[model samples]
Target: MYRYNDFDEAFVRERVAQFSGQVARRIDGSLTEEEFRPLRLMNGLYLQLHAYMLRVAIPYGTLSSRQMDQLAHIAETYDRGYGHFTTRQNIQYNWPKLPDVPAILSDLADVQMHAIQTSGNTIRNVTADHFAGASADEVADPRPIAELIRQWSTDHPEFQFLPRKFKIAVSGAEADRAVVRAHDIGLVLRERAGTLGAEIIVGGGLGRTPMVGKTLKDFVPLQDLLPYLEATVSVWNLLGRRDNKYKARIKITVHEHGIEEIRARVEERFAQVKPAFGGIDMEMLSEIEAHFAPPAFVTKPVDAYTRAHEADPVFRAWADTNLAAHKAEGYAIVTVSLKKPGQTPGDASADQMRALAQIARDFAHDELRISHEQNVILPHVHKSDLPAIHAALKAADLATANIGLVSDIIACPGMDYCALATARSIPVAQGIATRFNELKLEHEIGPLKIKISGCINACGHHHVGHIGILGLDRAGVENYQITLGGDGTETTVIGERTGPGFAYDEIVPAIERLIAAYLELRTGPEETFLQTYRRLGMDPFKTALYPEKDAKAGKEKAHAA
Candidate 1:
C-alpha cells in the first residue's frame, strides 16, 4: 500500500475544497442541474434513478485495512449501511446526501483516497490484476506502473477531457485476470531481451462496438513506456471523433482509421514527445515499487488446512472455489464472494465490510484487494488461517462456494438505480441465480460467467460473459437478449447474439433452458459451458435458445465459420 506524500495529501485536500465549493454553489441555486452535471461527474457524483451515487476510486483495487475501516465507517455513518463494489474495482454509495458529499470526500481524503477521475470523459482509475503482487505466476507486481500512470493522468491538463471516458488496465501475469483486452489501453508485462517490458494494446472496448484490443507495440522498454503512452493518448485525443458521442471511443477511431495508420501517427507523435520524458517517471516508478514490497511470511504448516479440507465438505468446497495460488509458500489468496444467493451482486453491508477488514488485519497482511469481478480478496492469507477465516465469513453469510460458478453472476445496477437504464438488471440476475440455486445445478454445471447489463452501455460487461444477458425495453415491455461464447480472458472474443429477445418473464426460463440444453449437449461434466460453446461453436446454444431460428442467419454464420 502506497502512503500519500505531502504532494498527494495536498492534492486531494485541494480537490476536496474545490468540489465542496462546487457542491455549495449547486445547492445555493448558483448552478442548475444542467450546469452542475459535468462538475458533479468530475467529482464522481451521479444523479441516478433514485438518488445521487458517489463512486470512489480504489487504485489497482488495493486498500489498507485502515482505509477499509474508513469505507466501512462511511457506509455505516452515511448512506444505507452498504456499498456496491463495481466491475471497475471501485465502490459506489447509492444514497449520499448532496450536502454531505464534501464531508464524505474529506473523510476519504483523510485516508488518502478520493473519487477523482472515477467518472466523466477523463482517464478513469487505472486498474490492474487484483492478484498482481501476490499471484505466483506474475512477472512482477503491476501496481508500481499502474500508480505511475495514475500520477501522470491525474489532472493532466492535456487529457482533462476526451471524446469519451478512457480506461487502462495492466496485467503482469500470462493469464489476463484484469480483462486487459477489453480496455481502451491494455499493458501486458513480459520479459524482452532480459529486461521487463510491456506489450501495449490499444483501442479495445465493449459498449456498442466491442473489440479485443489490437497490439500497438510488441515490446516497449520499461523506460519508454511513459512516452509511448503519452503518444497513444495524444493521438487519440487529437484524431478521435467528437461529432458523435457513440463513435467517440478510441476503439471506433481505430476501426474507422485502420490500426496501421493510427500506429503510424502514434509513432510520429512518439518521436516528438519521447524526448520530454527524461526518466522522471522511471525514478517515480522506483519509489512506488518500494511501497509494494511483499509482506514477510512465516512458513506455516498446512496440516490444519489439509485437515479441514479432508473433514469438512463445506469448507473444502469454499476453499476449492474461492482460493487461488499465492506467491508465498503456505499461503493462499482468498476471494470473498459478494454474490451470495438472493443478494445484490458485489454489495457488502457495513458489518460484512468490517468483518473482512478485521480478517485481513488479523489473519492476512493488513491488505485487501477489490477484484474486477466485484469480490473482496485477502491476497496473502496463510493456509493455517483457512478455517477461522471461512468460519468468520460463513457467519457473515459471505461464504458462498461459487467464485466462477453460475450463482456468481456479474450485473449492473440497472433501472433499479441507473437512470440511463431502460430495464431492471438486478432482478434479472437475481432470477437467474435463484433459478439455478433451486435447481442445484451450479457446481455440476462447472465454471460459467453470466453477465447482465441494463442497456447496451455494457457496464456489467455482458459482451464478455460466457452467457451474456442484456436487458432492453421493447415497445413498453422489458425484453432480454442473450449471447453465447463470450470471454474476457486472454482468449478474448465478443459473444454471438442469439436471434430474438425474450420478455421479462421468459428470460429466467430461457436461461434455465439454455443451461439444461448445455448439460445434455456437452461431452461430459468435464466440459464447461464456455469450453463446450467454443468446441462446438454457437449451433447448439442457439438451438437451445431459438429452435425456430436454428437454421436462420445465426446458424448460417455458425455453420459457415
Candidate 2:
C-alpha cells in the first residue's frame, strides 16, 4: 500500500500527457501502426486479436479499496464491464479502444496505479508473495523491497532496453506463493545470524524453455541487494544474446555461461557498483517500508465465525479452502475465488470488483491483494467478519470454495484473446472446472493445481502446476499436452511432459482419468496429489493420461515374456 509521493504523481501525469499526444498522433495518421507499436507497448498497450489490451500494474499485488473502486470504474467506463487478472499479478483490459487508453491511464494515475513497465523490454511488474505482510510465517514483509525495485527499474536508463523483458519476484514467507523460482530474479528474504538478507536465485524463467532458477548467492545483505541485483542484470544485459530473441532471457544466458561464471561476473560488477549506492537505495527502502507498515489490527470475539463454521456446511467448505492463517490472531486471509466454475478463470465483472472494494472497506482492513493464482485476497479480515464477508461474496457470485482444489484452475487467455496463442485455454479450463464440479469430486481430490497455457509462453505458469496442460496447434488441429509433477512452491519443480498430445475434446477426460488414478493410487486421503506424485513419480499418472500407450507397452512386454 505504498502511496505515491509528489514525484510519482508528477511522473505519471507527465507520462499520461505524453501518451495522450502519441495516441492522438496515431489517430491522425501522423504515426503508422509500426511507428505506434513500441510507443504503445511502452505504455502497457497490446494489439490483441480483437482489440488493444491494456495491462495495468498492481505493484506487488497490493490495492487499496479506493484504488480497487477506480479499477472497477475503468472496467465499466473505458472497456468491457470486466477485467482479467493475469498471472503476472497485473490486470488486463482486453477490449479497450486505442483512443481511450490515455484516459484509462489517467484514471489509474489518480489512484496511484499505472500501466507503466507492465510490458515492453524492461522490468515488468515487480511481484512478491501475495501473503507478504499478513502471512503467519514470513521473516518480514517483502513488498518494500519489491517497491524499491519498482522505483529503481521504472525507466532506469541503463536497463530500459535490455536484451529482453525482465522479471523479479520476492518471497517473504517460508512458502513460495509468489512462484519466485520461476522469475528472472527471485529473492527470498531471510534473517541470517541477526542480519536480514536474501537468498538470491537467478536465471529462472518459463516460456518455450523453462528453468528453476539457480541460487547465485547464499545471502546478500538487505542493504546490498539493490547493488547486487543491479550487477546481476547488468552482467546479463551485456552477455545475454541479442541475435536470437528466444535466447535473450537471463535464464538462457545463465544456462549457457553456467551459474559459477555468472556469479563471478555479478560479484565483480557488484564490487564496482556497491560503493556508488552510498546508502541512497537504503534510504529509499526505509521510506518505502514505512508506507507498508502493518494496518492497525482490531481484536474481538470470533463467535460469529465459529457459529457459521459449525452451522453452515457451505461456509465451512469455503472456510476450509479459501482461508489462510494470518500473522495476527483472530484474523484470516480470505481468497475470493475468481475461478468460479464455468467462467473465465480470472475475469472479474465490474460489479464484482466494486463488491470486493466495498467488502474490503467494511469488513476487512480496506486492503486487497491480487494473487498470481488469479484470486482476490482480503488480507486482514477478523474471524468475526467471516460470515458477513462470505454473504457479500455470495451475493456477488464470487463465493467459490475451491482454492487449491482442482476446479480453482489458473488459465491464460489463449487463442480466445491472445494473438500469439495457437490453441484455446479458456474453454479447456472451463470444461475441466465444470466437469470436476459436476462430479462433485474437487474437495475429495485435495490440493491439486491445474494450470493451462494457450501457448509455450507459459503465461498460465503451466510449467509449475501440479498438473499442467499446454495447448498447441498440431498441424491444423488443436492439441493439448499434459505435464505432471510440476510445483511452484518453495521447492519448485518443472513438470515433465506426458508423451503425445491429446485432442481438444479428449483433454478434459484425460485430466479426469489422471485424477481418478490419483484417487485410487494415493496412500490415503491424507496424502495430497503433489505428495503422492512426488512419492510415486510420474509413471502412474502418465499411464493414466495415455492408457493406450501404457496398454501397448504392456502388450509388448507380455509378448516378449
Candidate 3:
C-alpha cells in the first residue's frame, strides 16, 4: 500500500481546513446550495435522494489494516453502519449529514485517506487489479505506477476541469482483472525486449456510447508513460466535447474523430512535451517504487491445507471460487465477496470492515485490496490460514463463497440515490441475484457477469458484462436494455445491443430466459455462458426473450398458408 508522505499529509490537512470553513459557511446559510455545489463535489460530498453521500478514494484499491479500521470507524460514527464499495474500488457512505462531511473527511485524513478526486470531472481514483503484485501471471506490479499517476493528476492545473470525469485503470497481470478496457485509459504492464513497458489503451469507456479502447501505443516504455499519458489527456482536454455533459467523455471524442486521429494527436503532443520530462521524473518514479516494496513473507508448509480441503466440502468450494492464483507458492489471493444473498451488493457493515482489518493483520501481512467488481481482497493470505479466515468471514457475513458466481453482481446506486438516474438499478440486481440463487443454478452457470447501470453513464459498467442491463425511463416507468457477448477481460470487446428493451417487471425474467437459452445451447458444462453466447449468437436468445412475439409471427405465417 502507498503511504502518505509529509507533502500528502500537509495537503490533506490544508484541504480539510478549507472544507471545514466551507461547511461552516454552508451551515450558517452564507453559502447557498448552488454556490457550494462545486466545492462540495471536489470534496466528494454529494446531496443524494435522501441524504449526503461521502465517497472516499482507496488509491489503486490498496489499504493497510489500520486504514481499514479507520474506514470502519467512519462507517460506525458518521453515517449508517455500512459502507458501499464501488466499481471504481472506492467506498461510499450513503447517509452522511451535510455538516458532518468535513469531520468525516478529517477522520479519513487521520488514516492517510481522503475523498479528494473521488468525485468531480477530474481524474478520479487510479484503480488497478486486486491481485496486482501477488498475481501469478503479472509482469510487474502496476500499483506503483498508478500511484505515480495519481500524484501527477491530482490537482493538475491542465486537467482539474476536464470535459467530464476521467478514469484510469492498470493491470499488472495477464488476466485483466481490473477491467482496464472499460476505463477512460487502460494500462497493461508488459515486458518487451527484456524491458518493462505498458500497453496503453485510450478512450475505452462504458456510458451512453460504449467503446472498447483502441491501442494508442502498443508498448510505451516505462520512462515515457507519464509524458504520453499527459499528452493523451491534454489532447482530449483541448478537443473533447464540452457543449453537452452526456457526450463529454473521451469515448465520445474517440468515436467521433476515430482512434487514428486521436492517436496521431497524442503522439504529436508527446513529441512536443517529451523533452521537459527528463531525469527528474525518472528519479521521482524510483522513489515511488521504493515505497511499494513487497512486505516480508514467512515460508510455511501447507500440506495441512490440502488435507483440510479434501476433508471439508465448504472449504473446498470456497478454495475453488474465492481464492485466486498467486505468484507465491504457499500464498493465495482471497477475494471477500460483498454479494451475499439478500444483502445489498458491494456493501460492508462497520463490524464486517473491522473484522476484515483484523483478518488482514493476522493472516494477510496487513495488506488488503479492493477489486473493480466491488469486492475486498486479502491479496496475500497464506494457504494454511484459509479455514480460520473463512470461519471469521462467515461470522461477519463476508463469506458468501461466491466470488465469480452469477450472484456476484456489480450495480450502481440508481434511482435509490443518484440524482442522474432515470430508473432503479439496485433492486433489479438484487431481484436477479435472488432469483438465480433460488434456482440453485448459479454454480451450474459458470463465470457469468451481470452488470447493471442506473442510466447510460455506465457507472455500473453495464456495457462490459457478459449480460448487460441498462435501466431507462419509458412512459414514466422503468425499462431495461440488454446487451450480450460483452467481456471485461484480456480479450476485450464491446457487447452488441440485443433488439428491444424490457419493462422493469420483465427484466429479470428476460435474463433468466437468456441464461436458460445458454444452458440449453452450450456444448458441454465446461463451456461458459459467454463462450456459448459467442458461439451461437443472439438469434436463439432473442427468440426466447420475446417468445410471444416469435410465436405470433409463426401464427401469422401459418395464417398466410
List TM-score per model, in order: 0.97, 0.99, 0.98
Off by over 4 Å in 1: 547-561
* Cα lDDT listed for each candidate: 0.93, 0.94, 0.90
lDDT value, candidate 2, whole model: 0.94
Candidate 3 wrong stretches, greater than 4 Å: none
Write one digit per residue (lDDT tens) for candidate 3, span 1-561. Answer: 677899999999999999999999999999999999999999889888888889999999999999999999999998888899999899999999887888888888999999999889999999998888888898899998999899999999999899999999999988898888888999999999998999999888878777888888899999999999999999999999989998899988998999999999999999998898875667878989998887786788898788879998988988899998778878888999999866788989899999999999999989898888999999988898998898899888787878888989999999999988989888998999899989999888989999999998888888888998999998888989998888999888778889889998899999999999888999998999899888888899899899999999999999999
- What is the per-residue lDDT of model 1 for residues 181-203, given as tens digits with 9 covering 90 to 100? 99999999999779999999998
C-alpha root-mean-square deviation, candidate 1: 3.1
Model 2 ranges off by over 4 Å: 553-561
Q: CA shift at 28, candidate 2, in angstroms? A: 0.8
Residue 124 lDDT (model 1)? 98
Instruction: State the displacement of the C-alpha of residue 437, model 1, in Å, after optimal TM-score superposition.
Output: 1.1
TM for candidate 3 is 0.98
* TM-score comparison, 1 vs 3, better candidate: 3
